[model samples]
Target: MRARLELFASIRRDARIEGLSIRGLAKRYQVGRDTVRQALSDPVPPARKTPVRSSPRLDPFKPAIDAMLVEDTTAPRKQRHTARRILARLIEEHDALELSYSTVRDYVRVRRAQIDVEAGRRVEVFVPQEHAPGAEAEVDFGEVWIVLDGVKTKCHMFIFRLSHSGKAIHRVYPTQAQEAFLEGHIEAFNEIGGVPVKHIRYDNLTSAVRTVVFGQGRNRVENDRWVLFRSFYGFDSFYCQPGIAGAHEKGGVEGEVGWFRRNRLTPMPVAKSLEELNDRIRYREAEDDQRRFDGRIRTIGHDFAAERPFLAPLPAEEFDPGLVLNPRVDRSSMITVRMVKYSVPARFIGRRVRVSLRASELVVFDGRAVAARHQRIVAKGGQSVQLDHYLEVLKTKPGALPGSTALARARASGSFTSAHEAFWAASRRVNGDAEGTRELIDVLLLHRSMDAADIQAGITAALRVGAVSADVVAVEARRHATTSAAEGGPRSDRHRGAHAQAKVQRVVSLTQRRLMDPAAVIAGLPSDSRPLPSVRAYDELLAKRAEHPAKTASKENIS
Candidate 1:
């Protein structure tokens, strides 16, 4: 094509500049006169026309093949027509003996695709979208595999991405539940410091969409909680069309999910827990601030810095994305939520308690105070019982402590160490089993007031001194607490370390604290400029009464 065009251009130039004849040009270029005439007429060569070849053997059956292909469109996929089936039908029904299976196979391949294209099944068109600053965002969940706690597990990654700046937030969760969905949005909004002004895009996830209403163009029956969340955040939700048709609607987040999973979570991330994995993912996302999107002049962080002002300011406080459940604490001191049991304090047994079930944790509330909190149980029928919750019960049933499940869990969690076991054994050997276990329980109760490290140090000290008493452990723990506070700024012990409600329950009282700064306290008190409190005036009155007593008695007698 290039050579022919070049020849034509040379011929046309020569004819115009040198005024050569068609025959002369042909003779000079060593070509025929007709070629020189063609070059002179057009500078660019004309495209060669392809002659249509006739499939005479299958030509008569073309209409039948077309009809069959169209019917195949609506037919069950397994029952759809194959080239061999079409040939058999042609021979059996139409008695078209002249047609070969090859003829039918070749025709079916081309015409089937043509039918799909004509019926709008194969071809699709998309419009180029331009997002305005923080006007739009997209959310989706992606599946990622990870080595969690030495077990290979599949996790869902929640992705929230800005359409314009390409700044995205990724959080990995155990499940793609409604709680995680709402929690992801809250985290993303808080991390980004704002919400998209216009709307956030999503696919038809059951978390947000309850029912997808067809034939109305994106109309959806959204989940009630999701609707409330949307209203609270003051953002509209734009649900994409259902199925593969909707994939491109939020292509930004879809691509972002794949990009993150492939690049950041590759080699299957290994972590002890979801929180640890999310920490790593968040750090990687922050590092992504330095990267530029395709065809962009600025980095993602630069664009986000400029776009942040355009976003709607975040709400004053975040919405609590947790489900509140009122479950009765059963005889086991357990509350059943979603078929899983979590232990509360034994005192609450046979009473209903309020529980806030969040994405990762559940909090059992005794009025306004947090009675107990535990990492949520993921498996059905699984139980999460805190040893602290049953300590009061264990105190009465001291023998139960030896074989209790709570004790086993505590030991497994490192909360109850070998030091605790050794101390308990020593106490039991010195005293009876029941008395020794009660003493151990009292020592464990010290954890509520003092830091764990201090309590452990206290246990170590008591064991060294062979005291084997709860009071001794308490005194030792206080000493460690005070020493640590003096050395550091309450990082390990003392006021901040102690569990308190109304005030910091320190190792010493407020009076002792004031004694440390008496001069400052004295300056804060009112100035005492008046003389010392006097009895001299009362004494003067008494003396006058004594002097006038006899005269007063005479006047009284006269009256």
Candidate 2:
């Protein structure tokens, strides 16, 4: 075809250049006159050739290759033998066969329609029986590797599939905790538009099964809270046996598990945090549902749109993803939850406080406002949560004091007052023979149930007499024992006696003070001064002063 087209084109170009007639050129080129005329009139013409196809003799073994390709879809394309290899094998195996390598290649090329070159081979499309609207769903957990905050972590992938539409809802979480597992179901149900009426099949995850008893009967053991949550949500759980073979029983989710991992998580997604990773996974899963699977029929999302209404409506009350526990307040008036201490009101001391433990918060209430809120610490006993509960109690009752049990047990251990400075000052004075001061302190402490006025009065009496010794103050207390023991009590016999003794001591001390500072006494003289006085003359002056003031003055004048 190429030669014929080129020959005609060359002759027409020569005719136009040389002014040769079309018939003359046709003869010169040793061709038909009509062909020359057509060539001269048209710049180009289409070529024609006989179609050559593969001979059956060349690819007698094509049926065998096609069967192998169909059976092993997972095999690599290169691993599928070359056509030359197939031809040689045929010749060696059967001497009666005759086929060249090129012919075999041609046969393989012609039959390429049967080979799925892109996938190396064809896979049988999975077809599930049409299911009733609210019948069942398949549930499973897959694993995904992601980088959260620059650290690589393995996240659990939860997938739920509706039996009718093949609609899949999935999420990724940092942990496979029962809370996450159950919460995953709730979110999946919401995504699918409603909860399925029938059973949800699952593998033997510890979140669902506590133990996998053999033929005796599988235990559908789950966390108590999880069970309650499921009951509230209204669903039946079906657990598969704890082996690979059992996966066939719940093939829907099993297939979805792999399908989501491949289609949704393709290109190895990178996320800044586990939360971000989960968000990405959710978005892609939704997109996957909208995409056509096996390139046929309605998409998963489209089918789900129709099947959604048949599912049960979400209950009026949403599931509470919180754990409740009763934790007792410690002597510190604080309760420890999740390694953190939250304070309650001081009155709640020695009482149990109800704690509401959520994923991110630990909340404690005092029948009113939140008494304490903390970032939940997820540790057990001995690891405490410190709450600032009854701290204000300390402010109001400053003397309630603080000490370990042993400190309290040893009362005389001198950890008596929360006011350490006041205690220490009293202790020092008592040690310094100021027993009155110590007695005053003891009396003041006794006023723990008394008015401040009474205590202040007791302190005043002790200070007034300069008998501030703890013992002297004690003596005064005993003297006034007949009184109401309040600040203004009647004097008892003991009080009068102590008072008399105190007065006598004051007189003696005053007389003794004459020998020390007579000037003080002299300065306390009367306004009248008739005689010039010296220390020796003081006695005679005193004698003169004792007489009646007028008589003494007159007798002095007469003498």
Candidate 3:
């Protein structure tokens, strides 16, 4: 480059000083006449252009490949042919043995871009953007799997990220339903403390967009509920073009979802429930607030601290982030929601009940009061039941209690503890199977009004005195419940009572209990409504019979 520049400079300087002709300059510089003319005409040479290399062998098949690529415009994306497939077709169909896969691939790459640009379809380009504070945000959903209660379950992760600050919040839900979609926005808005001042960007998600007016234009027919939600929150929605072509529109959240899933949620989290898993994701979001994005001076938290004041103030009234459904409770005391069965109280059977279904739970309402609340079951055909919901049905059909789905779930959940089992066993030994189970069912009924710990304590109290009666257990349970109420209902010593026998093993005398607690021993439990039981009255009758025996013998002799 330097040598060429010096030659051009010397030729130009000499030509001007000596007034040399092109021939003289060419002779003096020992170069061609054209080169001397080129140096004289311009100080810098134009870039060299590569000559077009002809491929006569493959040239005939170029039209075929172009035709296939044109055909690909209308083909389903995943089913479209690759370069290798094109080359294989050329070899098989047209007998073009000269073409290699590399030749076809290189040509295909350049042609694909050219074709896209020519059609004004997927012309890939992005102008660097400067985002205004609180002006824009991005929302996206990514698939994530979590071990929910030991079952490997697939879940949807909704991410809302501020475009300027890069601050993001994520939540996991069983489905990407409209309720979850709207609920995610509400949660993110509340967490971020306000809504974006301008518009939030989104892909053409079905939850928001009912139809995309397919063209270069950004026209969309949105969901009615979504439109109302936007009106209520006072924010605008920006719909990106659909598919991979539009992924860049919401690139902030798109990249965030992938980055977070890899960095934080990589080792697929294990949780007992959807709520527990979401709690984990929520904490991770807070930690991300302190993160500094690449090439930025301010941390995400710092940028957001400045950006927050610019955001629009939240609405005074909150939006209801649940979908209302009126599902009729089946004869099984269960309602089918999204094809999943959830047991309501037996009283609601054969009636349509209002259910407010949220992302994580469903609350069944009878009138206005909640009849039953259960974690939303995600899996189709899955059933979730509360034992308390079916206790009434079990009363008349005591035999059904042993085989009922509610009982199985109760036992699995550790709600129906071993204490209940021990009491049931003792009762069966004292009475017969049918009668004993009926008594056990009565004891189970105490769980509705009494605390589980109090009920367990009552069961333990009855078993200690060899009182294998539901009546005795009820009396004892109420006593424990009243005592707990008097002592401010502290449950520092509370447990599942799985080891009901453990309490019986370490029996404390009444004197010892009085010594342990300095509080008045006379104030054991608030007075019972039932009369105190007395076997002493029966003993007194026996003494009277013994005294009257001689008198009764004298009366018989007189008769």
TM agreement with the true structure for every prediction: 0.75, 0.42, 0.70
The RMSD (Cα, Å) of candidate 2 is: 21.5
User: What 10-residue stretch in candidate 3 is worst by lDDT?
Assistant: 511-520
Report how far residue 341 has shifted in candidate 1, in Å: 1.1
Tell me the lDDT of model 1 at 26.
94
- How would you encode candidate 1's per-residue C-alpha lDDT over 293-343 as one tens digit per residue? 888889999999999999998889889888888999999898999889888
Candidate topping TM-score: 1
Which residue pairs of candidate 3 clash? none
Regions of candidate 2 where Cα sits further than 4 Å from its true position? 1-129, 216-227, 258-282, 329-351, 358-559
Q: What tens digits encode model 3's per-residue C-alpha lDDT throughout 1-559?
A: 7788889999999999999999999998899999898899999965678899876777778889888888887789898889999998988999888778888898999897776666667655798888999999999999998888898889999999999999999999999999899999999999999999899999889999998897759989998889999999999999887788888888888899999999998899999987888888888878888888878888899999999999999999999878989999889988999999999988877899999998888998888888889888877899998988877777778788888889899999999999999888777766667777888988988887778887898888767655667777776776675555545567425433422422223222343222222332333344224444569768987888798998989999999
Considering TM-score, where higher is better, how would the candidates rank from best to worst? 1, 3, 2
User: For model 3, what is the C-alpha lDDT against the true structure?
Assistant: 0.83
Q: Model 2: per-residue lDDT, tens digit, 114-196? A: 56665554444545565787778888788887665566666778787888788877877655667567768878877776788
State the C-alpha lDDT per candidate. 0.85, 0.62, 0.83
Error of 1 at 232 (Å): 1.2
